[model samples]
Target: MIKNFKWLLLVSLSFVACNNDDNTTVVEEPVSSGTASFTKYVALGDSFAAGYSDGALFKKGQEGSYVNIVAQQFATAGGGDFKIPFTSDNFGGLLLGGNVIAGVRLYFNGAGPAPVSGTPTTEVSTKITGPFNNLGIPGAKSYHLVAPGYGNVAGVASGKANPYFARFATSSGTTVLADALVQAPTFFSLWIGGNDVLGYATSGGVGVNQTGNLDPATYGGNDITDPNVFASVYSSLVTNLTANGAKGVVANLPYVNTLPYFTTVPYNPVPLTAEVAAQLNAGYAAYNGGLQYAAANGLITAAEATKRTVKFVAGSNAVVVVDSYLTNLAAYGIPSYRQATAEDLPVLTSRTFIGTLVNGNPAAVNGVSVPLADQWILTKDEIAEVKVATDAYNVTIKAIADAKGLAFVDTKVIMTQLSSGGIVSNSFTLTSAYVTGGAFSLDGIHPSPRGYALIANAFTAAINAKYSSTLKPVDLSQYSILYPAIIQ
Candidate 1:
């Protein structure tokens, strides 16, 4: 009887020990910080920084913004809370005073892109109270961030101020930089100057490339900003932001043409049959004959005549064109006509404009016969102009990063890798292949949520290297690739 009682006691003790093991809590691996303070993080930039996706800024985009992602990681590394000026709804609309200032977000509506139904729930007149973390304003240029009256609500209607800035500016006449400075940020991310070059490229180089001009006010909305002007404004911005001994990160501009927006459309998209091609060539025969005549008469050099020659073929071909820059060759009846070359870039919006009938003639398609205007094309010269400005801006940014002992995020190299082959992150690959690439949103220029997460990781790595912070990188799989076609 004593031996049986001892066996029962042993069994009960083993069962109790097993029950205790089942109830034990497993502690998660904690993220550590070497010595970085992210108590207040502020992000400053243009559309890309503002979480603008699907051609608009909305709640979901703001929620998944790279800055927000960084803030979350910062929390793990002894950082504090992060806040953003979130738009009211996922529809991405905005109202000012009482009028609709911006339209709703774009969604793929089975057939094509269209705005979601309903007006914006957020009203700009009812401004949210201040000291928000993310201060990115869409349509802001390098100079605009420092320009006074940039946030004046009264100036919104007159084009004197940016509507996006006006929506969240603390006062009527405060500049974006001023508001950012007021926050006394411990860490900041400055990604301005993209618009300085993007405006010219996206406008098909129609706007003036104000390369030599240092005055920004003289520049138009689509004009390429003067690199010197960008440097001056950017330097002043950094100097003021870092005067209080704050550490931050700065990023150089990416090659804008690499995104799907510019690469998706081919330069020579027009195709024609043998007979149709012959007919099209015949139509330009007069211009071709005139070029030869001009070369014979020596009115223009032989090289000039050849360069301006217009030709066509059966399969795929480019259209002939005339612009303000053709050497006034009306004497030879050349009409400054020349076929678009491979170096030209068509605007993404041209997808709809191409292949339409010209003058109601089916055989004479628009792209086949009616040449696209300068606004629809970026000539090789225009692309070169953009490159020069971008290079100069990058140099300035690098110099600033070095001088201020800040982290330099080489966005150009990152984008190049994304465009060339593919970037691998956490076992997933990302590319710059338009909507299907999983990196870019439907807008083709901005990154999707997952893409933004990848960017956040890059920034975190840069921060960790420069500031000795132990911020854990975000898992790319957690963020979304694309929003649903139609949200509930």
Candidate 2:
């Protein structure tokens, strides 16, 4: 009887195992190309599209770029080999005639961002052959894309050509648009125009705002491109890209002021004791007295004098800065020196130089005693200039995208979200806070690897929505927030 019972139990167990196997059969949703084609995909843009992170472009960074991420997803549908003009080594930067033209990549050093110890190996003069797909060049503005000889190796030393593009450009005279056209891409992506105003913002508004200047040749490297010029160049680029019936995606510029490079350093970062504060106040007593004299003499109003007063408190105090916008009393020997305010934005590089002693003198501090230069801070007026140009460029981008019926990504909204409360993706919450934020890279200007993943998802969603494609979004957990100092 016991043997019979054992046999029956074994049979029941086998029956349960068979049922479980049948129930556990998994099925995946088939990927579809939909109305779009990925037969020949080409990407054109600036550093962000090139996957530049930690202040430089390297092998890993290029691999993690949003353009590569989108192309990877497209592979499941009909995407072919997406080639990238890769650098020689993971240590970024560039070499021209065996000399370092650009600096190496930055990595976290347990405290903050620091450049890796090594020389770059990628030689700009050593050209790579291409009908390459990824045509994103670092430091490319809207007009640079359509400019001839933009990749000429000889022009690199003269600042007339981009070294990144020079590495892979087909011919010295071939335009970025012409190269893309030669490939005859079935699909494309364009995210240019960030560098248009980025240089001005990053330089703390030292660059001019050439809003009415129609000639790009006359524009400085740090100058903001005129909105009309951006619009004209953008329209031309799109017209050529879609001339042969190629579908593409385009992104608008974000307010560069919101980036960590401009927002990381606080305007008031000086902490002083009572004695120290008193000493500093005494040192500025003459300047304060001069301001009062100017007001009483009718050279300036009481309010204007008060606004220009340089005072320090016992605890935390704002740094003194030279504001060019202030009334010039230079003829009377009163400089435009004033204490920084909340409205002022300090550049990231200012953090290291703020409290340091100048010439090793205890009384001569950079931010306190020696006022910071205009290049170290962006005044409220300068911020407004950047906003106006950015707003104008975005408007032009949106109108062009609508008229061309292309996929559009509003990166301005994305950046605003990052600055405000952060965005939730999958199980992670990404913010714009530096280092720990997990969004921006060590450079504070570019996005981290995970940040690039977020951007890729944004681009893919736009593409899927516009083209009716079923491309899958990448899992954010796969990408890292920061690159380690030693890459193994």
Candidate 3:
């Protein structure tokens, strides 16, 4: 009986050891202090800081956000708990589905108006139990960061009442982000302000006209931000972030136009039917001729207007021109500077607008040709506007980071290399489309899982250099950054 008891005891011990081994996942954390000193960290930023992607906040993504991932690395190195938002699988990432995205897609349940994405059920009061980490609001801007209770659940904290961050916020109490900041963080990572520009560009780059005219598109004017205000608010936000004794890392904005959504879109209006094209072409040319003559007479600067062009679509024996420009070119007395109206362009001209073939390959344009994705190259004026604004924002960011003693992650410089196709690393390479490994998400603005990992590495490197800390760089091998799109 003694011998038998010993045998059972030995088996029980072995089982416990096996379970322990499975649970043990040791990872080296990155250094946060100068040359390696910080043992604690708190991350704060906007959407990029949060793991909100694919129009939904899934469990994998929310936990996998760079902030949380880096926190995990820290925990493995004896850092403390790395608390982040979590949601069950099969739940969406953000509230709205990712159809507007340039690459993200969803599994079909074979239903129309398919499920729109949804925010997580775990609100602030619930998920955040202890001293928290990773407080990134999805739609936060430089100025909005301090809006009291702006993004919180209907009640918890004032910082939790944001419309943009609403999808990720909880109704439990105060905002998860604002409360985390009040804890007096030791280390943080901040990357905000992308939405300041992205939101404007994505919304068709038009502003609503108070006139309440025929169509919203026609009435809207250009409400792009004034360059000066952008810098001032950015500085204010950055300065405040540092005032709390938090050693943080700051990132600059990426080129808003570089994303495939912006680059791979059409510029000209749609082509008209063969017979219709001829009739419109006559009126359109006559109208354009008059504008050109009038403009030369000091009536308008030719620089202000797009040169008229008649498009020849593939498989269509027709030439379509815009009478819209000519028709209202002289109606220039409106609030909008004599720029051509949406009415003047083809029916659909938005760079990011998508149309289903309902006939040909899913990627077809206007139900006909395989639309060339790289149609709307940024015009010189647009490039000038982007660069000038970007430079101003970067200057402010660098200054604040230096003052606050945080690392500066130069995302602007990093993204300049996103051209054609190239390998980002040995294990993962870049594909042109949404195939798994493609660096960009469907929206083109955000990065794919692989791409975000790349961002994490860059940030780690920055922290290492600035703080003299010896944080471990992540092994991105296990992660899947590419999309696998099986075109039907």
Candidate 4:
């Protein structure tokens, strides 16, 4: 009886030990800061870095910026606070003194993008106190970063200062670089040069390609930045940021042509019935006759005349466009008119104007009869110029990043992937399709919140590879593709 009792006690003790082992918690390895320091992070660039989405800089957009998203990941690995200059409300746009300068944010009203009905209360004159982390200014070019008086509120009206920068600059005379340097950032990210060419592209090539021009002050708001100027300004920015032994990540500019803003609208968007097509062809009969006459008279080549000839079909037809690159036949009372081809890219804003009647006259259709002006479409030549400038800027960016020993994100490659086919991130495939792509916001240029998350992962991956860090990427599913009209 004693031996049996002892055996039962031993069995009970063993069972208790097994139960305790089952309930024990396993410890996880803490996230590491890796070789680089992220105590003070500063992001420098244009609208993308500022988190400007749906066509405006608002509170929620700023929060969803890739900079803030990366900063959040950095927090787990010893990164400090990342301060952002938040707008007054989710309603974007700005007020200069008492007047509205910029427009409100765009939201999809089931059918298409429309402005959110509300007046923006964020005044540019009302400055925010800073040493803020994000130093991104919308509409800023490469040279604007180092230009003095770029943040002066008084200079906003004269185009001397950026209104976005004006709201957060430490003083009236402080440069963006100067303000950033004051913080002595341990880490940083620079993604400028987009706005430099973006203005030229978005304006449908109305701006000059200032390739040989070095003076930025003499350049127009829509001019493509000179490669030399970009190189010099970019190098200076990287040098100053790293002067204090700071490590950072830099991204190369993507070709703006790949964004949905340029790709969404088809060149042959005009659909016409057989009767309407015949009428349109009749309207262009005189122009086609002029081309034939020019070709026969040796005023223009046969191939050139054929290329310039306009004809409409029963189905979808290409819109007429003013191609300035064509030979000037104004001496013969002929305009430089030609039908648009697949190579041409129409600006997104042209969609609203393309099918509309001029002065409510059904016979005088804008795109079909009146012809689209140069400001409405980016011709093939214009696209070539933009590509050349973009490629040059990217080369400089990569070289400078390599020289500075910074982690590099090839946004160009990422954009190409998104434009062609699609890219899968965390089981979700994202494309460059306008509204349903799940990658771009309603503006068609800036990335959606999920798109920003993808970019953050890219930055983190680059940082991890360069610094040997184990930073985990955020789940892309958590982000929304579009912001609601009303924020709760």
Candidates in order, TM-scores: namely: 0.89, 0.93, 0.67, 0.93
lDDT of 2 by residue, 1-488 (tens): 99999999999999999998888877788898888899999999999988898988999999999999999999999899999999988889999899888889999888888999889999999999897899998888988899998888988876778899999999999999999999999999999999888888877788853332123353356787888999999999999999999999999988876689888999999999999999999999999999999999999999989999998988889999999888889999999999999999999999999989988998899989999988899988888988999999999889989998999998999988999889999899999999988999988889999999999999999999998999999999999999887777
lDDT of 1 by residue, 1-488 (tens): 99999999999999999988999877866776555578878888888788898888998898888888888888887777777888878888778777787788877666766777877877876778776788889888899988888877777666677777777888888888888899888888998888888878887887753332123343356787888999999999999989987789889988877887888778888887899888877877777788888889878788878888767778988765555466787754557667777887787877788888877787666666666777777777788899999999999999999999999888898899889897999888899987767898877788999999988888889998998877888889998778875565
Q: Candidate 2: give the clashing pairs.
A: none
> Residue 27: error of model 4 in Å?
4.0
TM-score, candidate 2, is 0.93
Q: What CA RMSD would candidate 2 show?
A: 4.5
Q: What do the candidate models score in CA lDDT, each in turn?
A: 0.81, 0.90, 0.52, 0.91
For residues 1-488, what per-residue lDDT tens digits would candidate 3 score against the true structure? Answer: 99999999999999999988999877745444444334557676776777765444455666667777677655644566666655434344322232221112332333311333433343333233344466676655555555555544443222224433443443324444555556666666778767655544543333332212112232112234455666776666556556766577789877765555555433443544666546544634544565567567676577533443332433332212222223344355421112122222111124324334536654344312322221222333444455566677777788777776778998876676654454466466664343233666554556666667777878878977887766676776765663222211
Per-residue CA lDDT of candidate 4, range 343-460, in tens? Answer: 9999999989998999999888888999999989999999999999999999999998888889999999998899999899888999999999999999889999999999999999
Q: Residue 180 of model 2: what lDDT? A: 92
Worst 10 residues of 2 by lDDT: 209-218
Ranking by lDDT: 4, 2, 1, 3
Name the best candidate (by lDDT): 4
